[model samples]
Target: MNIETLTWGTLDIKDEQIYHFPKGIPGFEDDIDFALITVEDGPFSYLQSLQNQSVSFLLSDPFVFYPTYEFQLPESDKEELEIADLVNVRCMVTIKEELESSTVNLLAPIVLNPVKRSGKQVVLHNSNYQTRHGLWNVSQDHFEKGGE
Candidate 1:
């Protein structure tokens, strides 16, 4: 199917690539359907809303930056998505940038079921997690070790 994307312009996406968020993202409850389009040569992706042209989120896999990160969602949420196995799950964190620092929302992650084409942004109850986790910390640590 062909869709107009903000980052990719008019592009073709496989039907299997479409994701449905029954309850939608926290603030974007009305926008349910979306397609994940990767940036041309970047690690980021755009979670573009199928219904709204202006509604899109920049997301990145947390593990790409923070390999040690872990998250657990309530069992009730798992039932909502019919998540039966880890293979069906894909986790992404929303990114934010400021003049001084860049951050990622690790407390709430957008989880998707590629097979079911459904998704939900789940907020973890873990007290150890924070809404804004510094992405720079991970970068600095990697750089210090001569790793990219």
Candidate 2:
């Protein structure tokens, strides 16, 4: 399918790349369908809304930055997404003017069930994580390991 995106122009994405967000992302509720465009050989991906060309979010695998980051997905959310065997988690990344100032949202992570092609942004209830964690705070070893 071809989607017109403000950030990447028109993109021909495979059907597997399209995810159905029944509840949508927190701020963009009406835009339910999104394409998960993964950047090759990196921990980054873009969640681009199919309903709105201008709506797009830069997402990063939080584990790449905070290896020890852990959270319990509410049973309700798991039920909503119909997650069973597999789950994919990615947080929104906010890029600032200064590269080092960029932050990734650890408070709310976008959870997806690839097998079912459904997703939702699950906000942690009692998490110590914040919305703005320094994107470059990780040690050089992380990057050297290519975020293993």
Candidate 3:
């Protein structure tokens, strides 16, 4: 299938590669169908919407930056996605940057079932997690002083 994207322009995508988010993301309820397109020679990916050409999100695996990161979804959510094993899941986070710091939402991770091609944005109820978790900046003096 040929997909029209805002970032990558027109591209071909296999039908099986399309991910369906029945409930959509928190703010993008109407745009449920998306394709994960990796930008050429780039670390980020574009979650390009099939329903709306303008709707797209830059995503990346949270573990790439925060190896110790953890995510948990409620039993009901698991049942909804028909998730039986962790191996079938692929997790990603939407990136956000602020002046000197870049942050990813550790509290809400977008979980996808590759086999089923379905996904959901699950908000962790864990108290230790936050909506905006800053990335590690080695250049900061406080980080060198063991402030991380």
Candidate 4:
């Protein structure tokens, strides 16, 4: 499918790349369908809303920045998204601003069930993760390994 994006303009996204968010990303609840676009062979991916061309999110695999980043998805969320296996779910953190001065949201990771084509942002509890962790603080070694 050809999707008009906010940053990259119009591009082709396969059905497999389109994730169905029953309840869209917070704030943009009306736009439930989104496609994960890879801008580069890196950690960054743009979650472009299929319903709204101008709505998109910068997502990053938190594990790359914080090697120790961990979280438990509540049982409720599992049932909500019909996620039967943990391996079927992919996790990503929302990125804000440019890489040098930006921050990554770790407390609430977007959990995507690719097999089911469903996704949701699950806010964690009893964790040290924050909504904004300074990007500069992440270890260079971790980034290097992640990029590889």
Candidate 5:
């Protein structure tokens, strides 16, 4: 399927790349279908909306930046996505001119059931994570040092 995106122009994506979001992401309830375009060499992916050319989100694995970042997937959400085993989690990233200032939304992560080809942006309840967590915190070496 070919989609015209504002950022990437015409993109011919495979069927497997499409994901259905029944409830849609927050603030984007009307846009239900998106293409999960992944970056082969990096920790980033593009969630591009099929319904809107201007709607696209940059997603990244939260764990890549915050090794200790963790969250529980609510049972209700699991059931909704019909997730049995395999699941993919990514957070929306807000990029800035200053790379150090970019933020990732940990409070609400985009959860996907690869087998079912479905996804949801689950807002974590009873969690300490915020919508904008610094994308670049301590250096990567910090994790190697195990925080000293």
Candidate 6:
């Protein structure tokens, strides 16, 4: 379906790309549907809202930046997203900007269940991870290193 995006002028996404967030992404409780799109050869991507064209988030695989980053999928989140195997899950972090000084949200990773076409932003409640981890820490040889 065709959608007017917050970043991209307009986009046509496949039905398979659509994800339903029943509880929404924390503060965005009213916006439930979204489409994941890649940023043309770049490490970044976007989680664009199908429900509200104006709402979109620039995302990136946090692992590429902080290789040590990890989190447990609270059973509540797993049930909510209907997540089964680890292969069925994908993680994307919010990229605040492109500058080295910019930050990425590592504490709350957005998890999507491709098999169920559902998603949720799993907030790591009591972790040392921060919401604004500097982007400069990203590995310079991203392509040389494999990704999930």
Give per-model CA RMSD.
4.8, 4.5, 3.9, 5.0, 3.5, 5.3
Compared with the true structure, model 3 gives a TM-score of 0.80
**Which portions of model 5 miss their true places by more than 4 Å?**
139-148
Clashes of each: 0, 0, 0, 0, 0, 0
| Candidate 4 weakest lDDT stretch, 10 residues | 87-96
Best by lDDT: 5
lDDT per model, in order? 0.72, 0.90, 0.70, 0.75, 0.90, 0.75
Worst 10 residues of 3 by lDDT: 138-147
lDDT per residue for candidate 5 within 11-108, as digits (tens), equals 99999999999988889999999999999999999999999989999999988988887888989999999999999999999999999888889889
- TM-score on alpha carbons, each prediction: 0.80, 0.92, 0.80, 0.83, 0.91, 0.83
- Candidate 4, clashing residue pairs? none
Q: Which stretches of candidate 3 lie over 4 Å from their true place?
A: 40-43, 86-100, 136-148
| lDDT score, candidate 6, position 121 | 83
Candidate 2 TM-score, C-alpha based: 0.92
lDDT tens per residue, model 1, 20-123: 99988998999999988767775577788998878888787777767776766678887888788852323454444552356667678788877677888888
38-118 per-residue lDDT for model 3 (tens digits): 667755666888999999876766666666666567888888877877523234444445433665666677787777788
Clashing pairs in 6: none
Which of the two, 2 or 3, has more lDDT?
A: 2
In the range 15-116, model 6's lDDT, one tens digit per residue, is 988989898888889999989887887678788888888888878877777777777778888887778885232344543455666777777888888888
Rank candidates by lDDT, best first: 5, 2, 4, 6, 1, 3
How much is the lDDT of residue 41 in candidate 3? 77
